[model samples]
Every structure is written in structure tokens, then in C-alpha cells.
Target: QHGTPSSPGELAHHATLSFSYLWAGDEWTFTDARGAVTRVRVDPAIHASNGDLLRDLAIAGCGIVMQPEFIVAQELARGRLVPLLADYRTMDLHLHAVYLSRRHLPGK
Candidate 1:
């Protein structure tokens, strides 16, 4: 993947391929060091509701995917998938946990 682009402008010269997931929208947005934003609308090569499947496809060299760090952490550590556009930051994803009242919680 020596020809792979590291910047948004260069990426545009290549096919904007991606693997689709239900929660992930059609756009891949990145904010650069100068605070400039780049929004990319991907041409999906595979559409899957499962993140694992998407990650697998990416590992198989199907196409590029924007997956959560936790999901691809092992692959990244093993050098299976290389990080791109390190200088840019992606949008933050917020997660929330819900449970019953504290009174219903078990005592430890």
C-alpha cells in the first residue's frame, strides 16, 4: 500500500472506498491541525451491520474502513492495518450506560 495517500487531498485522487455499518453514516470527516475540516463521502464496497464483519473485510484488504479504536486495536498492534491521516482527528463518539436505581444495585 505504498501508494496509499496520507492526506485528504491526496486521498481524493484515489477511490474513496469504505465498508458500511448501520451506525456509521456515509461521511468520513477529519479535522486537521490548522482546524480545517474535510468531509468525505465514501463509495461503499461492502455494507454490513456488524462491525466485526467490516473489520474482517478491512483486514482481508477489501477496502478502507473507519472503525473504533477498540475494535481494531489488536490488528493495529499486530500491524495488520495501518493508521492513515495521523495528523487529522476524527469526530468523537459519545457512549452512555444506563441501569436501574442505586437501591436495586447489588452490594459488593
Candidate 2:
């Protein structure tokens, strides 16, 4: 029912939303303009493992979700979702590709 959080401290006043096992703890870290890092933990009103579902919920005005830009790019472009905390930056996500060793591969 309230608007988006403009700062980390404001997160507590609003429903800090999240999704996925990676954000299971409902803790979010952000860097301020001065490069000061802050971590905010909240008991999410809703939690799920799917980003899409979370995005949809956020669009439906459930709460503010910390989702990837790509996941909500379309919504943001269409003015469905407005970005919050422009002054804070979230941590980068590192993804690695894993594969079986050549020796473990079966002959075709």
C-alpha cells in the first residue's frame, strides 16, 4: 500500500521483497554514493523461487522486489515497474558454467 523505499533504512518501513533460494534470508546489501556498504534484513511478506512470479507480484503492487534489470526490463520500459534506491547499488551476481570432464564423457 506504500510507495517504494528510497533508501536502505526505508526498507524496514516497507515490505522488502525477494525471491529465489539465493535471497532466502531476505537480506539485501547495497552500496551508497560514498561507497559505504549497508545490509538490510527483513521478513519478506512473500517469497518464491521464481523471478517471473516475483516480478508479476511486484507489478500487481504487492511490494518492491529486488530483481535483476533484465528480468524486469520490459516492465520498467513499459512503466509497469519503477526502480527504487537509485542511489544504492546491489552486489554483482557471478555465474559459472559447469560441464563434465572429457574423460567422463561417453563415446558417441
Candidate 3:
């Protein structure tokens, strides 16, 4: 496994796997304990739209991947993946659910 990066400045030396389609996923933002934000630009070694593929690539020692915790929970638990840069918080990824209003819509 690629060793943990203690600081944002060290990330440029390692390969990074990305799962972004819109952006190149090159630049990453993180928050520190003092609520300071740091942006690090990593070298994108591989780009895949699928999270699973990124996880697999990470597990195989191809590169570091910044993904949702759920996607790599098992690996982390089994010691297959080790978290890095704990002092900094990665970009918060969110998902929203939108549903139709039953009161305004006709019955299906």
C-alpha cells in the first residue's frame, strides 16, 4: 500500500484514482482541526466512473482513492485499506433524495 500522507504537500508524489465524471478529480479539498481548509492537487493515475472499480484499484495498490466510507468499510475493517491524513477532513460528499408530492399528484 502507498503509505499515508501526513500533510497535503506530500500528496503530489503519489498516484490517485478518481471517480469523477465532471471534473478531472485532480484537486482535493480538506479541512483541518482548526477549521482551516487546504486544497491539494494530486496526479490522477486512473479515472473511472464506478466507485467499485476505484476501490478495487486502491486495494490492488495501484493508487490512493478518496471515496465514501461505505464503499470501503469492509476493506478498512479487514485492514485492507488504511485511512490517511486523519488530521484533515476530506470534502464532504452528499446525496439528496427528491420525491413527488402525493397531495399534488394523481394516484399511481
Candidate 4:
């Protein structure tokens, strides 16, 4: 491996979900109770305040992030990033709405 594995044992940093009407996702800093924060002040070139970027950072080994299960379900199931704490699962919800929800219903 090129980089070091995420040291969850050192400190279990938690993820926070942001609710903004303009932006659905954001890559916030993973600040643990011990005050160890990472991926917050990162490269400007990779400045991302969205889900895609958050996943990118996670894959890139920058730091851990709280993301929707759909984004990292396959990875988790495949052992890409082992669960920090199986009992402690965190996620961010993306408020999605379809203009015609009933019209597209299956078996309606």
C-alpha cells in the first residue's frame, strides 16, 4: 500500500451531516472527541463540499467521512474500509424528491 491505513484505533472521529437547501452534500472535517481532525483543511485543488468529493477523499486515504450507505455500501461489503465500529454506523441523508413520484410508481 502506498499510504498508511486509516488509524481508527488512534481516535474514532465522527462524521456530521450538513443540511443546506443549496447544497445536498459537503466534505466536512472528521473531528473526533480527542480533537484530532483531518481532511478539513486539505489541498485547495481538491476542495470539495459534496458527496462525490467526500467519497474521493475516503478512497484517496485523505481521511474518513460520513456518507450515505448507497455511496459506500459496495465498498463496505467488499472490505475497502472496514467499519470503524460495527455498532456505530453513521450516514448522511440526501433529501431527494421526484417531480412525479406517483406517476413513476411501479406496479401501480
Off by over 4 Å in 2: 22-24, 99-103
**lDDT (tens digit, per residue) of candidate 3 on 3-106:** 66789878888889988757535788889999999888877899889999999999999998899899999999999999988888888777789987789877
Cα lDDT computed for each candidate against the true fold = 0.75, 0.83, 0.86, 0.48
Could you tell me the TM-score of candidate 2?
0.84
Would you list the rank order by lDDT, best first? 3, 2, 1, 4
lDDT of 4: 0.48
**Stretches > 4 Å off in candidate 4:** 1-47, 89-94, 100-108
lDDT of 3: 0.86
Each candidate's TM vs. the true structure?
Answer: 0.76, 0.84, 0.84, 0.43
- True-structure RMSD, every candidate: 3.7, 2.0, 2.6, 8.0
Which candidate achieves the best lDDT against the true structure?
3
As for lDDT, the candidate ahead, 2 or 4, is 2
Candidate 3 local Cα displacement, residue 25, angstroms:
3.3
Candidate 1 lDDT over 1-108, as tens digits, reads 438777765654544345454466677789999999998766666667677888888888877777789989999999999998889998786668987789977899
Error of 1 at 102 (Å): 10
- Candidate 2 lDDT over 47-94, as tens digits, reads 888889999999988888888898999999999999899988988876
Task: State the lDDT of candidate 4 residue by residue for 1-108, as single tens digits.
Answer: 223335433232333233232442343334455555543321223334576666666776666555667777888888775555333323334467767668667883
Off by over 4 Å in 1: 10-24, 99-108
Question: Which ten contiguous residues of candidate 2 have the minimum total lDDT?
Answer: 15-24
